[model samples]
Target: MTLTLTQTAAEAVKQIVARVPQAEDGGVRIRDTGAPSGFELSVAPDPEPQDTIVVTDGARVFLDEVAAASLEDRILDAELAQDGSVRFALGSQV
Candidate 1:
């Protein structure tokens, strides 16, 4: 299992963490929501116990075991909308 982040995504995450007071020393965490058959992404103060940590371009991404498996061989990217909002995109690695 692996998690990859694009340069833009890493920059975006860093910017967000800088703005969010509670996430100063934190990183992004991805977890699987088994019941809903989906994933949840949020900022965490640090990696939880037994989390898989992936560092990319200075951004730390923490993934639970399920999330790690789910996102294997995938890349995470960031896109900016016309309104300046950031949107995260996940794609399979080619």
Candidate 2:
């Protein structure tokens, strides 16, 4: 299984990637951080060799091996605030 994203999440990622310097190949990246949620989100200029890449509406998401396995059955959603902050949520795939 692979990861998936809601349209809002995809757009948020696209906007983030667009603002980064020298990030033509960049996208949002997710990794397991051993925290309670075990997830860490960030932007990467490129995917690592072992990443799972998911693209939607031209937006890209890079998932590390651990995160890929964990999120494979989930969907990503996002909310963008007027202050330019983004909140991401994960839900079980319907």
* Candidate topping lDDT: 2
For candidate 1, list the clashing residue pairs, or say none.
Answer: none
Tell me the lDDT of model 2 at 34. Answer: 69
Residue-level lDDT of model 1, residues 30-64, one tens digit each, is 89988664788888889999999998878888999
User: Which residue runs of candidate 1 sit more than 4 Å off their true CA positions?
Assistant: 35-37, 82-84
* Model 2, span 36-87: residue lDDT tens: 9668888899999999999999999999998999898899999999998889
Clashes of each: 0, 0
Predicted structure 1, TM vs. truth: 0.86
Q: Local error of candidate 2 at 50, Å? A: 0.4
